[model samples]
Target: MQATTPLSANSAATAPRTAQPVAARGRLITDAPTRMFHWLFALSFVGAYLTAEGERWRMLHVTLGYTMAGLLAFRVLYGLFGPRQAGLGLLWRKLGSAPAWLKSLRTAGSLTAVNWRQGQNLLMALAVVALLVMVLPLTLSGYATFNEWGVFPGEDWLAELHEFFGEAMLFVVLGHLALIGGLSVLRRKNQAAPMLTGRVDGPGPSLVPHNRRWLAALLLLAVLAYGAWEWQQSPKGLVPANAWSQVPGGEASGGDDD
Candidate 1:
């Protein structure tokens, strides 16, 4: 048989073919405000805890509290109006459910739901609840102490309770930070960085445009400022009259001057 002529060097090039660009890996997850609120709240909570009693520091602490409250309120609104991936409903819907692939009766396949981190998610949720529980009392008590309301005869009990919750919150926060750090290191994932950039990897819905987020953030700032201004201007916020001074023969023994 005659030796087959060697195929031309350009033969493969002439053959029909198709080329498609590979899709980019990773996608955005967290929104801008969500990220900003995370870090800012983290810092403010730490500051408030450390300088809780000092006069000048209390100003910063109070301002930060109002800011944190505003951020939390904004998060609620954003969850409703923002992207699906960042929305509260989406995040929590499948949370308590078994993984879709693993819910079937078929035993022939590996269980996909087996690896779901329900414990971790629950832990995070608990931390959030604890933070809120602690903060509510702490914030209200701070306001009470500020107003000098002396609702319970002496504000000492309220003040102590507020401090107790505040400290408790700090402990939980430290745990949260530790979890993030550990997860990042173990998975080689930058969990902390996402809060700064408000972006995340993996499949997710489209991000809200920066412009919209900016407007939302501005409104948040306005509300926060209003809260702070109100706190400062409210007459009840002045330090309370000392109990000893108000008592018989105890004049000059207690009060702000003391």
Candidate 2:
């Protein structure tokens, strides 16, 4: 048997050290229900917007509008009763910090020197608050116009008010999207990923302890049931019979408005 010499300290130190591989890092920052609500709310608004102009699509448009109102109601309830991470009070506090951000802006030597992140957060909060505040009036005016309730003094005022709110909502939606895209580019990270994936890359405990997928499922089921019931209520169906006749060539032709 060959006698082996002990390894020197420098040689042992020079040998490549293999550590137990560090696991891929991530933390769940957004919960399932919040993400589901976010997408559903966005889609409801978009569907309503696209169908706003078409007579044949009026029923679908109305359904989507009602969906928005209902979704907002659910969101309000969730924000009020759910975890602290998803609270309206949190939004209000963020909005309350607006004065501080404004004060910072005033003190800054230039616009670029101002806290852009703080300003961006404030703007985002403003857009969200605007959207939430506007939904009730938007839906109410839409309902009035639909039923010819004549809630307003004149025939056209209700319609005009509805249109105005819709446009304002659209403006806020676009701003919200632009802010996300801009921040994503500037930060070299997808700002919207948290909503999309409900997680952010890092080694830390999840900010949201529970995923609350069951709540999201229940919300989805409720929306679907409502939509199905609405469809059943319409005699001609979700796609009105007028849509087929409206096509210049035939039902086969795509003259159907968005």
Candidate 3:
């Protein structure tokens, strides 16, 4: 079997890259901006989640939550207007084939007898959608909770909902990681490395030509600046005003906490 093949522009446009041995250093399959978004989003969620429990880190938590919201905004704009391969539409297209993929399973004697790769792709698509869509609810509810928006009907309901979204996102994230692990084992290659290095094991021109490192750098800088600004705006030395002694514990004091 051929280890690699030349990727012509025409075939690249026509073919669907359904999770091959996509890892290591070779031709680029992912651009810098996409990779930057992925890592920053992950870090923001993790940092926010870790600091969610107490008053001590409330400001930091709020800042991190806002960071997630901003990152989501960036992702939405980029996916809508960015490169074709990195577009959100690609995921939607994968999801569009779900009906047919599900229909194919009915003919199989056993579920495993069906196209596993196709199923994997569908699951991945679903996971991505879940993660993306959950962000809206997560950040919205988080913002409300931080403001103590409603101490009325079903007191703390918003907080509970925000927590629920966080847990749900965590579940989907774990599943995504599992899918990557399974793909790596099945393909006898480190599938996760491609995401880190934005490359795969092949010899040809990059599928995503522009690395766009400048954009990634700018994104990183923007997030950092925002975090620092939030810190400085807080009443205390570095903590946000809310956490210092404002509305209540876990509440943002004042100034662009959103």
TM-score versus the correct structure, for each prediction: 0.63, 0.84, 0.79
Q: What is candidate 3's lDDT per residue for 132-250, written digit by digit as tens?
A: 89999999999999888866866888889989998989899999999989988998999788679998887788889788999999999999899888877886534534444444565
Q: Provide the RMSD of all predictions against the true structure, rounded to 1 decimal.
A: 11.4, 5.4, 13.7
Top-TM-score candidate index:
2
lDDT of 3 at 94: 91
Every candidate's lDDT = 0.65, 0.89, 0.85
Minimum summed lDDT over a 10-residue window in model 1 is located at: 235-244
lDDT of 1 by residue, 1-258 (tens): 888888786997798878887775455556666666566667767767766876744655676666666666666777789767567775455544434424542553554634435545555655665665566677877778667666566448767877777877888988977877877886798767766655567676646444256754776577567756866885544233453465588767532553
Q: Which residue runs does candidate 1 get wrong by more than 4 Å?
A: 1-25, 90-116, 151-155, 202-211, 216-258
TM-score of 3: 0.79
Ranking by lDDT: 2, 3, 1
Candidate 2, after superposition: displacement of residue 109 in Å? Answer: 3.9
Clash pairs of candidate 2? none
lDDT assessment of candidate 1:
0.65
Q: Tell me the lDDT of candidate 3.
A: 0.85
> Considering TM-score, which of the candidate structures 1 and 3 is the better prediction for this target?
3
